[model samples]
Each structure stands twice: as structure tokens, then as C-alpha cells.
Target: MQGINRCPPVKIFVGLLFAFALNVMVFTQIYGQEAVDSNIISYTDKLAYGVDLSTDIDEFIVSGPDTENFHLVTNNDVKLTLRLNYKFLNLSFGFSPGFLSGNDDDELKGDSSFTEYQVNMFPGRFVQNVFFRRMKGFYVENTEDFVPLWQEGTDPYLQFPDLKSIEWGGYTGFVLNEKFSLRSLLNRQEWQLTSSGSFIPALRYNFTKLANTFESGSYGKENQVDLRADLGYYYNYVVSPKVNIAPYARAGIGPKTSKYTLDGVVDKNTYFVSDYGGGLQLGYNTDQLYMGIRGSFNGYTYKDESDNTISNNLWHGLFYIGYRFETPEKLKNLF
Candidate 1:
């Protein structure tokens, strides 16, 4: 990679603070401007604000140029995301702190002991994990086989000091008939459905980026970028005046790119990705306040056929509670 600059943990936290403050300011401004006519209607009640705490389980793999050898990598990420909505517009931003846990990790030291064993102690390290070893934040430690793989005066080992990364992302979307959090409650008043279901379609997009692993002598970096668009439908069934149960299904495709560096050589590739799944949503919605919980399971895989031999399949589970401000259609704007 050209350089190694770790994204401090503060970035995500600061971003969250900024997003929340901006939403608060927006709410105040909208409310302040409503003095023009308390009885006259100028704008629809089209605003929502909320936050979500989520966990993402990410899995990865490494193989040779021809995709011969295979190794499994995984990460557990926890995030705090903030969301805002106005009319058909939707926006969300989130942050995930740095954490590392994999093969040869030292639980006591909270670092990668793999670095010392592969780079410092092992003598014949050049023959093992050749591709994964040269990654930005990874190092080689000698296992003390006592014989150097290369000739005398040759040192193939490097130290990266640390091997951890932080991740952050944002999302934007358009809802045709309904939205999350706010829509569930509004639909109750608009349609006056006593019991039954209705269909709502949504268009969604999201992008995620993470810092590279290694510190120096890197060609490129190891990180991911994914952009997806999906048009999905949900059926909302009202169980009670205060509760609604919904079953949702969606299928979408996108491009997922990953970058890796070895010996100052960069291998960056973008693979066609596809995802499909369904889930259930339960919420308590009203004109002034709304609260809800949702759960979903999804499956994703790369379009590259070469990975078929290996288990490149990935899946995720989501559970989050959402709370948002709601305004009565009769009262007008939510300020």
C-alpha cells in the first residue's frame, strides 16, 4: 500500500455525535418555522429520527493467484447507527470500533501472537502463507525451525506492530409507499385497516469501508467496498391498535470489491454480488412516538465461479430496536 494510516476509533463516535446533533438542529428549525400558520397546512408531516445498535459478522478468505490454496478469515463487528428520514428520503450512518480475533491470537495480551510465531520464531516462513503474509498489517514470525529458507544475510520477516482495523459506512434510500419506524404508525391512521395486510415497496442503497490491516511495506491494502440496490416489498398486518406484524422479502444484486497487497504488488478485484432473504417486523407506532423491533436473516455470495470449490458463502443475522419521532397528520409538521 502507498501508506498506512489507521483510522482512530474516535472517527465513528464523532460521526455519530455529528449526525445526532444535525438531526436535532433540523427538528428545532422545522418547529421554529411553523409559526407562519398553526392552522394552515403548508407541509406534510414527513420526518423521522432514530438510532440503531447492530452487530455484523463478516467472513473472508485468501487463496493463491489461481485460487489454489485457501484460508478462512472472519470478524465480529458491533456498531451504532443513526438514521433520519424526510418524505421519501432516507439516510443512515454508523461506526464500528477496531477488534481482532483469529488464529494464534493472544487472549491475555489482546494482540496477534501469530505475528511473532510466523515472522520472528520460524526460520522457513517463506514457504508458508506466502500471499497472506505480505498483507499490510500482517507480519512473519519464525517458529525456530533453525534453518533459514533463504541464503545467509537474507531477512524475509517484517513487523507491522499492530493488526487491527475500524469500519464505517452510510446508507440512502427511497420508499415508495412506506418507510421504517415512522411509516408503520402512519399507515394505521391513513388506511384505517382494522385487520389485514398491505404491500409497500422500497429502494435501498448502502456503502461500507474499513481501514487496511498492516502498517508499512505494503503494496495496496485489504478492505472491502460494496454497493447494492434492491426493490423489495413488505406486507403489514395489524394485530392490535398499538401493534403491527409485518413479513418482508427482498432480492438484490451489487458489486463487492476487495484489495490485497503482497511485496508492493496490489491485487484489487471487484466481484458481482447477490443477496436475498426475508424477515419479520413488529412495532408499536403512534402519532407522537414509535418503537419497534425487527429481525432478519440474509445470505450473500460472490459471482466468481472459482470460489465454488471453497465455501465462499456468507450469511448474516440482524436484530435492532428503532425509535423515532412521529407527527399527527392533523397537527401537520413534526417540530
Candidate 2:
């Protein structure tokens, strides 16, 4: 780790953005049109654009036989996102604007930043997603566990201002039932007129890097790769012609390969990991406008040698409003 950077370099981030843009163009050109069951699903064939306001809380819990459990968490923040959807391609970019008032109270929790780029494609019954995300800065969440008789309001949590994490991953899957439309629940380019459900199985893979600027650390830097098979059930209940409620749950288990660097030496380890998540979404859609809110909780856990375990848990909420309109000839031809 002598020459390695603590975070992904600027070049890699720029390359990822370019790759995401390239995929958006290729997918829109090739998979822009597809046939589906007319009764169960309705396609507008129009371009949709929108903005989303989201709030997320993420934390990591570490436990060992000899040490007490402690939590490291990022500062809670609100994020802004821009989204565009045309036919099969759905692309979004999210970032935290420094102007947001709440996150600036970093004196207690430390400062943090988050950014992500994601692309989703829906072709008939198949779904594909690719995403890259970066997060930096964290502080101890359970300060009481570390400081004796610590007052919550006055005491500052232990901060790791140099900690950073970067992850990139993708998943591909297909819908089991043709009657159920996953597109209606996700991108909102299609409308589901009837209540239906489907079983989705997908293959997911990701690479993650975790590092800190500390010169002498037990785990100087860690890189991990995970490949998992996930099975999920999604159901949409159409209460009215323009309103729907959807619920989804998923679980996955897989093997993780991790490489840890310490004092110029490297150690490799393998562990089995499990993850679970469930969420609810309520949406209202019309020919030209759409709005929705969603809430979800997700977590994954892995045990190392001798009962040492680590878990990452996240809670997220999102609200979005958007409009759809006929695709202009200029925009379609340009891509």
C-alpha cells in the first residue's frame, strides 16, 4: 500500500462516468423498442425526466469476542438526483450539494460526501443495472460504548476523516411471469393496470475498496470482491387506474474474497456473506406526470475468524416527481 492512493483516483471516476454515458447511448439505440402484454402493461413511448430528493443513513457494526461492539456511521445527508428515461434506458446521477444546511453541522459527526451514477435497462422481461458509488468520512455512532459517562450533546464522536470507500457493481435478471411488469414499479415508463407479482432471480457482482490515510494501521487497506445470486419477489397492487402500491423483498448469499494490507504485507481471506432487504413504494402516475415515495432497509453480514463479525446496514427514503412528454426528433436522432 506504499504507493496506492487512499481513494479511487480522479481518472477512474471520470472513466466510469464515460462508460456509463456510453452504455446509455448503446442501450437506447439497440433496445429502445420491445413488445409486452398490452393488458397487463402500458408503455407511453415518451421521454421522462425528473429530480429526486433522498435521505439516507448508513452504518457499519463491528463485533468481536474480545472487544465490545461499535458502530461507524456517515453523517446523515440529503441528496439531489437527476434522472432521464427514454424507452429502455434509465439513467440517474446523484450528489450531495454542499449548500445543504443539515449536513454542515459536521462538528459532531464529522464531514462526509457521497456520489453515485447508475443506469438501468428494461427490455421486455429482463432487467439490468450498473452503478458506481463513493463515500468518505465516518464517525463512531455509539460514542457511549467508547467514552465513559459521555454526554451525547456535548461530546464529539470519534471521527475517521480519512476513511473512504468506493464500490462498483451490476446485476442482471429476468422476470418469471410475463403478467407482472417490473418496469412499472421501477422506472415508471410503463404502467401496470392490474395487480400482479413475479419471482426474479439475478446474478450480482461488485468490487469494493476501503482505505484510510493512517500510516500505521492494523488493516492498512482492504479490497473485496463479491459475487452473489439473489432471489426476490415483487408485487404491485393497483388500487386505482393511476395509483399503485408495491412491495418487494430479496435475499442473497455468496462468498467474498478479501485482501488486506498491513505494514507492507498482504493477507488474503475468504468468507461467506448473507444479505436481506425489503421495501415499499407508493406511486401515482398519469399520462404526463408521476410522483412517488419509497422506503427501504438493507443489510449484509459476514463473520471472520473466531466469531469476529461485521455488518453494514442502511436505511433509505426517496421522493421524486417527474413529467413525461413526447420524444423530440432532435433528441432521438442525436443519440
Candidate 3:
């Protein structure tokens, strides 16, 4: 009778021991899967290095220095960009090389000064653009130059930035869940995206400038600095394991806090800026590489010191191709 009683305790102990062992095995498997998932990206990752090519196509209009009747049309102004990124950090370098100048000749009405101003202003104008948003300004030293170039009785003069520029910055990311995350940036870049799906809210500060001389004393000196924030969101649709589509939206506002001198003239300009946009991205994802094309419509409205509102609208597009290099062939030999 004593032996039978003792057997019950021993049986209970074995049962508990088996259950604990089973739980440990299950936990180990889950941990292994999580570790693997963190290292490999679906359409995005914690670290990556890659390059991107993009451009902005702008259609701008100028109306009234005195009356609402003054109007001038500037069309198809293009700025080409090249970007390099490493994880949360990025650096972009851009130069003004105006493409599709075909109808630009007639658009300025054969006035050499207008043509000169339009051609020379592209680099600086494009460089001043922060995160695909452009500033509005006229670089004329004398107001008298508006005649013949503008409507005879009205006022007009503004051109794209013509110059060389360098942009450098960094970003940080946090995950909230499978469907949402947050990213914050302190840099000159814009639009942080993922292929699976995510909502990213961001904050930023940007400093943009124009070069006094580039390519053997070409381009001029102008600079502007600004602070801004954006609320961004996107969702992904899967077509296959390797391909997907993402559509996104963003809106933001801030202020232009600094001014610069242009051609012996101090620019007495003050600005309050607002921007919003939407776009789509198509991507192909794999273990070692990811690439995609994205297109978006971007608009910016600026209120100057005179309380005059100016709007610039653009179709911005980007092409990206990236390959991760962290897991080299030699790493597999460590085991």
C-alpha cells in the first residue's frame, strides 16, 4: 500500500517534466523564426544600401504684382536627381541640367534675358526644392527688366534654381504593429516607403543652398533653410510573392526661416508653406535584391509676406534598384 502511494507522486513528476520540455521546444522554434525574419526583408528592412534616380516635372504660373490680371506660364520644368542611401542615412547630389528645352524657346517669347534667366535659374530652383517641394522667387536685380519679358503693364520673373547641391541626412524607424509603423527623419530626403504595407509619420529639418561657382565658375550663390513635418501612410497589395503594389498619401506644413541675397539684391521674402501628395509604387522583392518604380503628384502652396498665395504643382517620379551586401559568402562558413 505504501509503494502504490509513492508511485502516484513519481507519475505526477514525470508528467510535469514532459510538459516543461515540450514548452521549451516550442519556445525555441518561435525564437528561431523571429531571428530569421528580422535579418531578411520582405519589401523593407532595418539596413540597406542602394541608389535611386528621380526627377520633378513642374508647371508654374505667375500672376499679378499689382493686379490680378498679370499672368505668365512656365511649363515642363524638369530637375534630375541621383540619390544614395545606407539604412537610415542618405546623401543626394543634384545639378541643373534642363531637359526638354524644345518649346521653352517660344514659351519665353524669344526674349534673350528671359531665356537667360530661365536657363540659368534651373539649377538653383531645383536645388532649393526640399523633399520635392519647391520655393517661389524672382531673381531679378532691377524691377525694370520686367518689360518685354513680362506683360508690358504687368510684372513677372521667376525661374528654377540653377546650380549644384548636396543633401545629407538620416532617419530612424519604430514598429507599432504589422499594419503600421513610425519613422522620423533629420535630413533633406523624403518619402520613406515599404512594399508590404505601413503608415509612417515623420518630422524633418532641411537646409538647402545654391553654389556660387560650379563646373569652372558656373552657377550663383543663394541659400534657404526650413523646418517641416509630414504625416504619411501607405498600403500594399500583393500580386505574388515576388511582386507587389503600394499606394501612399502624405501632408505637411512648416516655415521658411532664412533669406539670401541674389545679384546685389537682398531678398525680403517671408514664407509659410503647405504640401500634400499621393503616389503609387510597383516593386519586386527577393532575398538579396529589391527594385521598384514610383510616381506621385506633389503640390506646394506658399503664402508670402504680402499675403499673396502662390502654388506650384508637379508630377514627381522615381526609379530605384537595391541589393543588400551584409550576408557575404564568407559568413556562411562561420558555422
Candidate 4:
């Protein structure tokens, strides 16, 4: 409870929402009337709401010249999300229901919980995302590699019940092509009638901390600050006026500064890390209804002070269905 309590509270999340609202107001005031090719792009004044089902899993791997790989993982459970969009504003809330939280064999894999708050804003050709994530508990995925003659179905894996991780980060980027409609594909606020592609370049940053509840002298804690620049390409193939398929890929290299505390001793080091990912989305859109499915994977790798290489990877898939309706008079008045 103490470890989880160290995370930012609800008030901080509310502050993020306030900041996002300000961005939407300022950006819409400046670009609301900007004209575009209507034949190629179209907008809907209706309000939209949706339900999304998703699964996200993280894997951490550590290896050294004289050591075999050690894999750590958290339970990959289903998350249910409710999303709402009005004009340029979007909001979402997500949670895992007990029934969907998969079997909890805590003795073998330990218990885990994940909490995150994220916001995405689009102002013209610019894209921005800000988020915070906190995760607790993990278990070794490759138990047989360390525990000799371990039975797969009967033996328990090594669990890190006291481990905790927290991250604060975001990304800002620009879309290159004026003919492309990123909003059409991502937010469902605009619909594209023609197939097009764009080159996007983004800057990403993160402040991360990893720690355990064990006493000093052990793997006490590690803090990392990193910044990277990525270039990605996205293309939407308009299979029909109401359907599209999109594929995108990106890669980045960055500088990472890490501080470590072990046995009450502290050490600091810097390294260059590399990141890469790609994803695909298929969607069907109409004036009053929309649905889609998407899958993506991303990862980063770096070498530590002891020459041990550590890598983190995340893979997720999502299915969403949404409805659009006329904006109520009161909602329109607010805008």
C-alpha cells in the first residue's frame, strides 16, 4: 500500500485534465474555421462515445555475457474502456473487472495492479500525448532457467511482490502531409475519402523509477530520464468510402541517464538507447457509427553500468465500437 501510495494522487490527474481542456479551447479558437478540401476530408459535428476492450502486456529481459536471460512479466488482463469525444476534446476511463482479470495464481506469479492516466491532443498538424503509469508486482517468466528441474505446471516462479514502477512521460509530433487526415483514422472526428500517407517526426521523453520494498544493499532503486526523436510513416488505404486500413512504423534512438542505489551506494551512468514499433488498424466508419481493431508492439533496450543489457517490451491489442449522435444544445453552447 505504501508503494502504490507514492504515486501521484487523483488531484494531479484532474490537473492534467484541466490542462488538456485549455489546449483544446486555445487550438480550436485558432483553427476552427481553417478551410480544407471538403472533397477529401469531412467532419462530423456530432458527439461520439465508445467502448474499447484491450490487452496490454509488458516484458522485461536482463542478460549479461556470463549470464542467461531473465524474463519478468506482469499478468496480462483485459481492460474495459469508456470513451467520449466532442469537437476536439476526447476523454476515456478504463478499469479491469474482477471476472476479466484472469486467474490469480498469486503463489506462483504474485499479485499485480496497474494504473494509468493519458491524454491525447491534436491541434492542426501537431499531435501530443501526455500520460502517467504506475505498476506493482512482477514474476519471473523464465523460471526453469534459474530453478533446476522446475515443473512447469506444478512449480512456482520467483515473484517480486514488493517491486514497483512509475513513469511520467509524453510525446509531441507533427504530421507532414496536408492531404492526410490523421484525425480521421485516430479520433474518428474526420472522415477521409481518399487514400493518403504522411511522414511524422516526434520527440519523446520519460522519467521512470523502479524500486523494491527490500532493505538497503539489495537492488534498492533505479531512476532513469530519457529523450528520443522518432520518425514514422503512416498510410491509410481507403478500401471503401466507409472503410480503411492503416499501417504505421517508427524507430528512435536517444540518450538515457540512469541513477542507481544499491547497498546504500549510489552510481550514475548515461547510455544511448534504441526504440522501435509498428502497428496496424482496420476500421469501418459512418456518420452515426464506427468500429475498429488495432494491434501494436513497442520496445527499448539499453546497457547498464555492469555491461548487463536490459530491455523492455510492450504489446497490446484493442477492439472498439462507437456511436455518434447530435450534440445537445447545452453541449454546443459550451463550445
Candidate 5:
């Protein structure tokens, strides 16, 4: 009787081990099938929409005596970005409208600028981007001077002319890691004022995949933040007489551009004075969609041969709203 009892226990142990091995084999097969199915599905079918708003401020200005001046500027920008993504493939489209204004004290002048920019892009597979931009503004000696430019009888020549531009470009990107992507873009831009075309070559690297953290269930807490840094070389003909090359970094909720000013002075005379500042963007995103705000900073510096510089900065902000829809994946678990 004791031997019989021991035999049943041994048999039961063997049966349990066999069942566990079979489950493991079944799980491996299911995972393999899912991977194959994922490859067969087109990523474009999964598209989502997003909106962003941003605000930014410049830390300081570097200029000459007549050319180097400082003023505070503010910008309000609204953007709608769409994403087409599946598995490892991703594409995006974006549109932004911005308003900028300058605040000035004595010895510094004020200005107002407005711009609208739109872009279409494919991020990973083969990077491509097309953009259109329009800007209009007035450079004023003072607040009183700016009002006259808007008046019909006032001095139109005193104000900066309206500028419009369109650009198209394609680039290839290689992903070095989850946090880095190297890209090079060749672009052609048309400027309305000069009626001239410009070719630009740019190489940039993305340092942080902030959006990925959100997707990975890492930022589930309230007020989660992500920071990304970028370093880039832009050789372009539109902004300056010579190729202006600068390195810039963007750290915040999302991607940003850096601001620079180009100033040229002749014999106590100032010519071609322009201000450019980086942008700030903040947004929240989920698997299905995203929403956010953006702000632009604009400022100007004017210099004379004697080394007198006048600069002013201003602020403007805008609100953005958008949505996205993506193809749903198969649900694996039902409870």
C-alpha cells in the first residue's frame, strides 16, 4: 500500500513538469506569431493628432555699442502636429502661427513681428520636410513710432517690409540609439523680398526621446517633465550675406529653435538689423493624441560705426488645439 501511494506522487510530479513545458512552448509560438503580424501591418494606418503651445524668454543679448542692445520679447505660438506611426515607423505634419512683440526702455527701440510656419516630416525611415513661412513686422524707434506704421498716412518706410518664404527639404536619418538620431537635410528656400532662392544644408542630432518615456509608462505622475538637447550646424543663405553657422540647443517639453541676430553697421549708420530668438514648447501626449502650447521670442539689435547698439525684446502668445486617430492594435488581454 505504501509503495502504491509513493507511485501516485511521482506520477503527479512528472505530469506537472510536462504541462509547464507545453505552456512555455505555446507562449513562445504566440509571441513569434505576433511579431510576424506586426511586421505585416502598415505603420501609416496608425495616425494620431496633436497640438502644442509654448512660451520662451531670452537670457541675454550680445551686440556692439550701437549694435548691441537688450530688450525683452515674448511670443505666442500655436501648433497642430499629426503623427502617422506604427511599430517602428513614424511620420509627422505640423502647422504653427506666431505673434511677437518687443518691450523697450530708454536707449532701446521696440518692434513687432508675426509669422506662420508649416512643416511636413517623416522622422525615421527617410526624413523629409516641407515648410512655408510668412512674417511681417515693424521696427520702431519707440512705442509711439510703432503706432504710425499701422496708420495709412504714417511712414510705411519706417516699418519693416512683409516677408514670405517657402522651403522644401529631404534628409536621411540614422538612429544611433534610443536617445540619439543623426540627420542631414538639404533644403531650398524662396524669399519674397529678395525674390532670391537659398540652399541650406543642416546637420542635427536629437538628444532626448522625451516622448518615448511617456509611452513607456514612466511619466504617469502629474506634471512629469522631459528635457532634450540638440546641437546642429546650419549653413544657410537667407538670413545673412554670408553663410551663418551657429550651434544651438533646445531643452524643454519638446523641440525648439535657437535665436540669433545679424547686425551690420557702416560709418555711424546702421543697416540690416534683425533679431531672432529661440522658441519654447510645452505639451502633453498619450498613445492616441497630444496637446500643448508654444511661445516665440523676438528681439532686435542695431549698431553704428561708433559702436552704439540698440536692442529690444517683446512677447506674444497663442493657443493651439488638435486631435489624432490611429489604427488600433489587437487586444491581447481581456478581463
Candidate 6:
């Protein structure tokens, strides 16, 4: 009884500590800047209009003692995403809407049930300087999913639930030379999913010049290309997610977050799990807009408390297209 009573206080204390730390960091950055440059180049000065469309298809097969009777269950999913971005005062704001759906079926019978998922995200960013940049951002995501279950001699049914996730983070980047840069991001994500929270810390190296040099100075000519690689850890409730299978095909890694289970028991020991993958990035950027696509392949093994292990693999893709408009101040200069 006493232990239960103590939980609330601990949570409150931690929450307050985090808030204080965030406030301190923000203030320090704001005050540390020497002064606002009158000659600063803002994103509004390079405004371009664009649009992006993307779709992904993934298939997974799960088999084991528990799933053997079901005889090779296969899951297929597809997602479509769209986004828009605008710049003002050297800041950028982006909004993305996505639709996803999938089906699970018996490999032999091919008769299966379907599930649906949807998500929308709005992320806003503030950039301190255009040449050397420090960025801070906040994002909120809303998601909905429908899960279907089937019982023998009974009709298959669906369960629909809506979920929300929020993240606030900042990235600081240093241009090491002209073509290379180092970047780091710290983000906190809270999900309505299972009442879970995750903290992600990532470090990336940017190869910005290699891809940009190849394009011509046309309307859609690419001004910058980033060949980025990152290593990060996901700290989640009761478990830490690991990146095990590193895919090495593209210029950058794709979504680094996933779930892995072994046997029937959830494996909390990092060494006992293999859950890692990498991705590829291809995109074009103009003065006003940036568009890109990322694709990744991931594999992991998970165990239940019952000592059963399940292996899963996923191939996912993301397409981002957006337009950036000039700020009012920059518009004034154009006229």
C-alpha cells in the first residue's frame, strides 16, 4: 500500500525536473547568442513552392508453435503521406497527414481480416541563423487504428481506438568544413499507446556537398544533399529498444524505432534481442522547399515470459514533399 502511494510523488518530481531543465536550456541558448545579425539570410528569402506524395507497402510472415496452428500468418500494410512547410523569421513549420491500412491473412487459405491506421503530425521549427544553425522544434501527432480479431465459428470483428503522441526536441549542428557537418538531437516522445514514453538521443554526420554538386541550376535543381548516418538509443518503459540489423543501401538511415519480442516473454536484456536496421534517403532541395524519400528494412527477435521467441521483419518507406513560402519581410524585399 505504501509503495502504491509513493508512485505519484515520484512522477511529479521527475516531471518538474524535466520541465526545469528544458527551460534552462532554452534560456541559455537565447542569451548565449552574441547578437542578431542584420545581414542574416532567412529561409523566406529563398522561398519555393512544392508538393510531395509517397506510398509504401510492407509484408511480414510470423510462424512458431503458437502461430503454427494458424499456419503462417501474413500481414501487409500500405501508407500514403503528404506534407507542407512554410518559413517565417528563419523558422519553418510543417504539417503532415498520412493514411495507412493493412491486412492479416492465413498463408495457405489467403482469407484474412484487415486493419486500418491513420496519423497526422504538425512540427514547428525555429532556426537561429541560416549559415550556422541551431534549431528547436515541437511536434504533436494524432493516430487512430482498428484492430481485428477472429474466433473460430465466429465472425471477425474490429476494434477502433484513437491515440495521440507528442514530441519536443532541439538539434544543434556545426558545419565542420564546407561539405561536412555534425548534428545531434534530443527528443522526448509521449504516446497514448500503452501509456508509454520514449527519449531518443541521436548523433549524425552529414555529407551535404556530394549530391548537390551534380545538379544544374534549374528551377528544380538540388541545392543541397545530405548523406547522413545516425546512431541512437530508445529508452522506453520497462524495456530499451535495440538496433541490430543495419541496412546499408542508402545515403541515410530510415526510422530507427521498432518493437522486438522473443519467445512469449518480453526480453528486457538488450543482449538477448536483435532489433536494428538502416535506411536510404533520396531527395531534392531548392531555396524554398525540400522533398525526400526514405526506405528501411528492419528485423528483430522477441521473447515472451513463456520462453518462446518470435522473429519479425519489416520494410518501410516514407515520402516527404512540402513547399516553403517567404515571410512577409522577405516578400517586401521582392516587390
- The lDDT values for all models are 0.42, 0.83, 0.44, 0.82, 0.30, 0.29
| Candidates sorted by lDDT, best first | 2, 4, 3, 1, 5, 6
Please tell me which predicted candidate would have the highest lDDT against the true structure: 2
> Per-candidate RMSD vs. true structure?
14.4, 3.1, 21.0, 2.4, 26.4, 19.0
Expressed as tens digits, the lDDT of each residue in 209-235 for candidate 4 is 988866343557889999999999999
What is candidate 1's lDDT per residue for 96-131, written digit by digit as tens? Answer: 334422332322112221110010000110000000
Off by over 4 Å in 2: 1-33, 40-44, 215-219
Clashes of each: 19, 0, 13, 1, 40, 21
Of the two candidates 5 and 6, the one with more favorable lDDT, higher being better, is 5
Q: Looking at model 1, report the run of 10 residues with the lowest lDDT sum.
A: 116-125
Model 3's TM-score against the true structure = 0.51
**Candidate 4 vs. true structure, TM-score:** 0.91
Model 5 residue 174 lDDT score: 25
Q: In candidate 5, what are the lDDT values of residues 1-335, reduced to their tens digit?
A: 01111123234334533543454356446544222122111223434443434333322233563342332222222233443333222334443343323222112322333233323233332233322222222233232433444543243323222211112222223223221111211111101111122222233222111111122233211111112222222221223321222222221122222222222221122133443444443333333443444455555454434465544454535344444454455511210
| lDDT tens digits by residue: candidate 2, 238-269 | 99999999999999999999998866698899
- List model 6 lDDT by residue over 1-335, tens digit each: 01111123234434533553454457456655222223212242334443334333322233456543111222223333332223221222222222223332222122222222111111212212111111111111110112235343343322111111112222322222211101101100111111122222333321111011111321111112222233333221211121111123212242222222222233232213444555654444444445556666765555544455644455667565555564467566643
Q: How accurate is candidate 3 locally (lDDT)?
A: 0.44
Alpha carbon lDDT of residue 7, candidate 6?
A: 22
As for TM-score, the candidate ahead, 4 or 6, is 4
Residue 37 in model 4: shift from native, Å?
3.5
